[model samples]
Target: MNQIVLTTLNARYIHAAFGLRYIFANLAELQAQTVVREFTIHETALNIAEKILAEQPKIVGISVYIWNVSEVTELVGVLKQISPELVIVLGGPEVSHPPDLPAVCELADYVVTGAGEKSFYDLCTQLLQRQTPLNRMIEGVSVPLPQLASPYQYYDAEDIQNRICYVEASRGCPFKCEFCLSALDKTAKPFELGAFLDEMDNLYQKGARNFKFIDRTFNLKVKTSVAILEFFLARMDDELYLHFEVIPDNLPDDLKEVLKRFPDNRLQFEIGVQTFDPEIQELISRRQDNQKTIENLRWLREHTGAHLHTDLIFGLPGDTLENFAESFDQLVALNPQEIQLGILKRLRGAPINRHTDEYQLRYNPVPPYNILSTRDISFSDMQRVNRFARYWDMIGNSGRFKITLPTILGDRPFERFLTLSDALFNASGSTWKIALKRLFELVYEVMVGTLLVDSEQSQTVLREDFLRSELKGRLAFEETKPLTKQKVGKGIANKRQKMHQ
Candidate 1:
């Protein structure tokens, strides 16, 4: 019975459509006629189209992102084929910029770029009223922070119980990190504190526990950050977990004091230590104090109970394998819970595009266009690092190998791991669909046979890691058969590393 349908293919089901809710909240009189539906990329386009057409929407709006762009393009094609008159509106970061707009954006009946909460409503109203604009693209005008409606009220009971709800106290980032879309924003903008907190309390009372703040820099404003932390702390329980992306060097004593108040593992800080090289930092107009970043990371590790998930980019204008390895080793030495190794991507409108020719950069020319090669790093070498990142995630970040990781990383962490990565790929031949039990057996074999670690010590720690994993099985390497039977080069080719696509 609804005339307007808002939909998107979410990367995962647990991620509720935060943007769709914002647009839904501001729909005004059209609110009653509208419905929001979310699907995952795992679904086929025809299957998703069937569900959307079931709504009989007069105008359909699809939220697009880099991860889902490829699937969504297929969705748009199918929708047009089946329902030619069905108005299709596209919006979100993937469709916001032109010149590099993907095929799906071009196929959309209308595109709303930038902040779409208000703009989407305006476009839908015009469409339904038969006052459609001649121009296909609509520029999304920014609404004042106070005037912007809170999207939290749209979360139903199911969302509150099962999903990771996204909330933002502010919009935009003041720092001009050239690789990010937020760099295009003039400055950070905060919503009215009292009103925002009221909405948060409402969400908490309604059984929402997992909150992920989408603000680009949650720690940018010390007073605001402290207030939010204290608010959550006052209502803290074992079930309440919060996540925030904080600037690496900006933790003051005030922030630290509040951070210390939070109990263990309740808070996670995604610190952006993209690269430790000053030259690369300056190249991308990323201003970070490496010394303070190191100091703060060490302090957080020692003084606080928060889990640290640090980031490092593998490919950049000035990055070479040697320097990136140095950055990787630096992060390993700090001992964060997770070291996210991200490959540099050419976001459509990001200022990093200016460095293309000088760096000899080659992008994949696909969705989530990651850098394939640079002047200093060849394509083959980049692929090696790509595989290494996947292996590292399974071994280092998964917390499965907590007992044996230090032994694997050793003194020259990156060098040794890269060597192991090469050997792993050589043994397995591909890097996907690796069974957990099989991976343990492979790692045990590699450590004992390929890397030539002391067999007794490697088996001891690896056995501890296996026990900790709680994965019940007799490891192929640990079978009752004689040592000669479990060969390292045997059909363990079943699994390797797949760089998270």
Candidate 2:
């Protein structure tokens, strides 16, 4: 049986299977029989090989990521060994670069960079027709296409509704944020706006309401961004919501007026205010007019009902932990819906590679490759910030920010959690499952004691978080058991430890 298998190492439990869904839907449109399976990062080489062999696929495509490349590579090796005739293809951000992508090219027969919707379909058609492989037909910086498909290939609504649904009105970013992986290419070409609106209509019809535009900066093109916002605003209903990553300083007054007309929760903006320090910003090729960013942010808060999600990064060139904390304090005073704290992830292709020595940044030599701040922010301080990031994710992103305990936790719980998380991390000895389980257990206990007045909702959300966290652990099948309230907590903790260890 001729078959196509597309898979990815998932980001988390709840994320809709995007790449596979896209490819499968495209094939369905072409009236082709196909199967798409997804696995987590923990799914081993043997595990993947067994699944592929079982499927007896004619074609196998694996979506690669920085975190999952090693495992994916091993999987590739095993699959090739078992059946060298299997047509193996790789794609995604991890391979969206020059032809000399040693890591990707070494593992697979073909590397598909950039938007794979049209290219992937063409490949399938050729393979079926007994034509030569159309690897060169794929398009982007590395390979230019004479024709590219309309940004069709519907993102699965069922898969995207619960987690953030990422839609791209455009590709590429105009910014030069050195640390930003998205900013690698500066050509920001948008899809035809009307065509984009049509896609949005289809998605909306499919029951997708929460959308996060994958545009590097949604507001870079004032008129285009405004048009899209107006279109959504015209269609606004209680269930419709949109999130954007915008440059705070560039926000227009007219846009402010438009935003003010919506409910506070109708729109959300994740502003990357990586640092307030001018030196640091310039050093990292991030040129935000700080004064303008501040003014624009203030105006956004005062004039608009849009919920704000701001971000700050630790361990940038000159940013000490103390300096980052100061920035954090300032952001807290602004009271965004959430303050996403991220450490600098040294992605292979980011411009930050050029400045490793200049910044004196020492990083972990493994997956995620986060930096340990230099003299500006000591190793201890980096640890503190890491703990801070965990606490923020638990209380802030988990939607527990409204509780009184979050404030209490914000006041002093971070320090204690940091200590405990560190100790647990050490004891668990790189077993992320155990460390996260212990972290979640402690965080939940603290929240329950201090802020979990609404136990019913908190418990529901916490359990969901636990399920997502489970995706991070080493994979082992346990038959689904009926969970009792009394045993749920213990069961979750035990499962997490099992996955990690």
Candidate 3:
């Protein structure tokens, strides 16, 4: 039986909790007595409690985050009720801040704030030795790169085989973007490149093909970026996929040369262009050269085969709905593979709270404290934008509506999409539970019928887009047939022939 169990409810099963593994790996002499257990937030709190209790762990340490905080709170309460003697420990971004929410901390025996590896190890050592730990709140110290044990060695057979193994060569962010918790970090720290690469090489040899780097500023150093790219480039295969969150406008010529070498479907870059509005950027202390960012995006789309996933946040202190629309239209023009349209969230300890009174920023007082309304954007506007984000994901970002997307968006992509968004929401009264067929129908009806697009051309375009999707379900229109292999091939050929013409 494990004496210490490191557990957390991930948003999904595919996401292996890197933080928990770090704590597990650093247990040192206590490694044999420890185990790591992960569950999805979908699992009921009672169920998670039952499973943890079954292990009969002397201490249960949970890695908390904004996404799983609500479920974890419930699970913690249940665990305390079932085994009052159980030593409950909490760590991670959610609990690692000032003004600890009483709802979560009251039940916990201890809370470790910030870099948890050494702190967790010490706490476990003291508990196992029957020595009363001095404090309930432990401020974690950053362990030196060489001194800290690599979490990668703890990856099991199943993890390497199936899960998207997260590896980080660095931690922290240099930019002080007010909306983000990373702003509090003094500076970015890199692990020794040689040692970090050796760990990556080992992981690769063990059949871990999907590597998602969690570094905030992955492309900050060109040499380090190139080395990491070359390491994976030499070992490229059909199954190989590497994801990194890059500095949008910081693409040096050296970085560009290496980036172009990566094959299609192998590299995916997540660029956070939170806003293009200079006023909003200034307000949030977000330093972004909009021209450079746009140029980089266009070059990546034209020259490189990297799947670009760009981000845009809806609400910020100085942002108005009009300016946000302008930013949206700008992003849409770049035509990235995916546009992650997110509403601003007030994370714990984020300096965004400083603008609460000034901007009249109100947020939901719960996990994922999403901005309800700001001085510039009203509650109604927020709801409208929320619907727009959802619809944009379904129609625009899904990459399903290739030919018809421009037609649907017209000249003003944001305005057009917002119109459709409002229409769809008004008709259905719900953003979710929309089937593919119904969504297609809604788009056709709203864009073609109500908006008065050329009916014949719109129908043809919609039919081609629908067939291109290769959806298993029935089509929105009666004339469309099920996509057979032969039909799909013919449709693709016809589209290719038209493109050549």
Pick by lDDT: which candidate is best? 1
Candidate 2 collision pairs: none
Candidate 1: 10-residue stretch with minimal lDDT: 492-501
lDDT of 3 by residue, 238-306 (tens): 778888999999998999999899766667789999999998899889999999999999999988878
Off by over 4 Å in 2: 17-35, 42-51, 97-105, 113-147, 151-153, 160-164, 373-375, 396-501
In angstroms, how far off is 21's CA in candidate 2? 6.0
The TM-score values for the models, in the order shown, are: 0.95, 0.74, 0.95
Instruction: Point out the higher-scoring one by TM-score: 2 or 3.
Output: 3
**Residue range 1-501, candidate 1, lDDT tens digits:** 899999999999999999999999999999999999999999999999999999999999999998999999999999999999999999999999886799887678999988898888888888889996878988998899888777899999999998998999998999888888888999999988899999999999999988999999999999999999999999987688888999999989999999888877778789999999999999899989999999999999988878788999988899998999899898898988889899999888999999999989999999789989999999999999999989988888777788788988889899989988888898888678888888887888788777779987887777766765556666765666322222112111112211100
For every model shown, the clashing-pair count is 2, 0, 0
lDDT of each: 0.87, 0.67, 0.86
After superposition, the stretches of candidate 1 with alpha carbons farther than 4 Å from their true spots are: 479-501
Q: List the residue pairs that clash in candidate 1.
A: 431-496, 431-497
TM-score for candidate 2, residues paired by index: 0.74
